[model samples]
Target: MPSLGLKGADLMCAAPTSLTLVMTDMRLSFPSDEELLSAIRGHHIGDQPLCGFAREFGILHEQLLETAAAHAEIARRRDELAVEVDTWVAARLPVPHPNASLHTETVGRLLDRIAEAQVHAYRLLMTISPDDPRVHAAWYRLAELVDGYTDLTREVIQRARRLPALGDRR
Candidate 1:
């Protein structure tokens, strides 16, 4: 309900004067901080108290926006620095064989395939009635497949662990 000394375009460019804007009239200036604080401290619900609170809240809002921008810039700089360090470290390290990650790739692909098969099996099982004899057989089949997959995964992990490290001829 009070003017904030800001016009149409100036509204976006000017420093915040109050927490709200209702009309574009002349800016309603407040008294000095000391006087405003004294009035606010007295806890009176008048013009000075309202103005004091609005001024402080507007300033806090601006400060919070600035703090958020600063944090985002810091995060961006940290990410850039991390990339630079990674690049430097990578350049200093020995390159591995092209197929160094083959096992991992294979494992990832197999896992994806297994997940797809399991989803299909589940859908099929859902189509059959719970009381059907075939439903019980399907459940047993799913259990067996899951057990086999778990055992296979364990064996693969064990074999991988026993393999020689990269660049080691022995």
Candidate 2:
């Protein structure tokens, strides 16, 4: 319950370095774009030759690969941050914190952040060209994920409100 209490807030706060913090280190430096691409290539693509489809799009492959790497890196970092936040929340929030409004307020703040991130992602997606298959593909994937996050955040907020409504927890 403490995790649900804070996991979304932290994830909502720093899901990516873009979402917020750079858990890679306190130096605030992120891996270079080239480094991220290389890491992805080594793990997944692994000497896979680009087909004629990629050749047709030229630079599209580069952008798509970078975007994919960024996406995966963000997801990875979010999980890392969640573990850290969970540990802190477990200590502070406990089984029944002195105030349930804390849960409600934290979750409410998280909901707002999730909504903002989703809206920002959607606005950027709209600015992209529909005719461009490469970008649209990435946009579609991102839009789907953000929408899901928005839904999940809403659900968490609703559940958190229940603790307060139950009487003593509040």
Candidate 3:
């Protein structure tokens, strides 16, 4: 059976040291970003002892927070863009023989714009510090929006295909 590698032979094979040695080594390793922030913010480590490191880490953390906020703003703008495109699509799609060429061209342009916006957002999100939970959540939301927009564009393509003269002209 597959093991969790936390006990007995698995643990021994992974690290041929006693559990106490493993625990001691783990404790000596540098703390994670969250742990560092908690230590500095909570004063778990004496201020005088870690003042320089804390200040530097604080600045980096603040920068990451600002980046996360910017990502959120970009996401909001993308949402607005999506709404605008949806409105334009709705207005034009209902008209009979609404310049099929123009309609298809507009839809393609909108999809391209959405794709570019998503790419920019993803790049910005990737620059954010990985340890920040907000970054992960924002990336996930952006991914969902990208997926939804893609699905919507596929539906638009289907609608365009159903146009009696569209495939014939193409």
Candidate 4:
């Protein structure tokens, strides 16, 4: 879908028409837990993040939240991580957004946008003098939290992905 102020089919005109185009144009496929962690760490500030952002594209399959009779852990961890990430990010916001206006974003984009804010926080800390222990401490804590997020997300990908072995039983 187009973003706010984006008009017509042009929404994706600038965006690549396929995954291959995205990988070739910016080489930012998630492809692994490490890359996602790097994104969470705010390392990719250029077209890479936009491309890496593409990694998030098809990763949020509903199967990732599957809760079968045999695999209760899938559901449990998904719910746990969802709440944990949301609560942790909410707590870190410098100030809450006042407007509750409607949005057209997909769930993945919403999550990505929040993660971007966390990255922005790191950006702010980086600009501060390193001599200041206070900001560095906060930055360290944020990094740790982002690591935790990466772990949870990786687990979701590993166990919850709808492999052929898993089938469509759920």
Candidate 5:
């Protein structure tokens, strides 16, 4: 009778100079085509496959192209959103004094604060549902921050404009 303890064969290929021992613990796994395709799909970015082998299968061409197109569409949408956000911010914020570094720095800090508030609002929205009361509150807080920054920036720019040049006589 065959030994019941033996689940698989211990493969060994011997050479004159060296010997390689293969065991069950060191078994190699070749994933199925479906599994490979699925993995490739899951991790692909910006129209490029994470794994080079994703292009090996002929059947995967159409699927890969479709996935790449989807990624490209997502990228395009993100770019559009970025442009919209910049335009929105520019519309709301006061322009800093051209020759005043202090005015620019003050405005820069206010912008940073606004960006932080926006990030907080975004995170809250992501964590909670759109209809949640907290989501609305977060958005309100972000708007208030921006409004406050706008008021403060206007004051700073006005103050900077009123300051006379250092070498000028009164």
Candidate 6:
């Protein structure tokens, strides 16, 4: 009866037999990628070469970088479109007069801006998870704005269309 020197309360009494079983079970378990690499490199559990693990890690790291870059580009596009829409909306808001002609121009411009914003937002939504409620809300708002602008533009265009030509038609 050799003392295995396993010191841990009740387990210490059953140490020798339990330790053997545990070691056997652990040896039978599947080795991790690192372990496999170490084995391949002629190193057991101690100091191992791990060249294979290094290669695999490198490949995964590169893929992660590529994914990050793509996501960044998408974010950049969304930001650019948002800024453009904001600028267009701001411009349309403060025009000197609320006349039919001005209204028509403003609405037309706003509609165009809304259309662009919708496209960008849609692209972003496609990339993001559908469960994101904020994106859905923003999309709805964009749609409403586009519709409103379009309706306004149509009314103005109709009114302006009915008016006689501005130039002297003598």
- Residue 93's lDDT in candidate 1: 30
- Per-residue lDDT of model 3, residues 23-119, tens digit only: 3223112222233323323333222212223323333334444675665655554344434433434433432334333334333223334344434
The parts of candidate 2 lying over 4 Å away from their true place are 1-79, 86-130, 160-170
Worst 10 residues of 2 by lDDT: 47-56
What are the lDDT figures for the candidates, one per model?
0.35, 0.31, 0.36, 0.36, 0.36, 0.36
Error of 6 at 104 (Å): 8.7
Over the stretch 1-170, how does candidate 6's per-residue lDDT look in tens digits?
Answer: 11222233412111111101113223112223334323222233322112222222223333433565665554444344334433433332322234545332332134234444454455558778877886788677766764664355344334431222222121
Model 4 agreement with the true structure over 1-170: per-residue lDDT tens digits? 11222234322222222122122223212223334434344333223333234223212222332324534554454344444333432232222134322223222333443454454444556677766786666657656654544443333333331111111122
TM-score of each: 0.27, 0.27, 0.27, 0.32, 0.31, 0.31
| Reference-based TM-score, model 2 | 0.27
The C-alpha stretches of model 4 lying farther than 4 A from their native spots are: 1-34, 37-117, 160-170
**What shift in Å separates residue 80 of candidate 1 from its native position after superposition?**
30
lDDT of 1 by residue, 58-117 (tens): 333334335656655544433333343223222323333344332322222222233333
Model 3 alpha-carbon miss at residue 151, Å = 0.6
Candidate 5 has what TM-score? 0.31
Which residue runs of candidate 1 sit more than 4 Å off their true CA positions?
1-109, 160-170
TM-score of 3: 0.27
Runs in model 3 deviating more than 4 A are 1-87, 94-128, 160-170
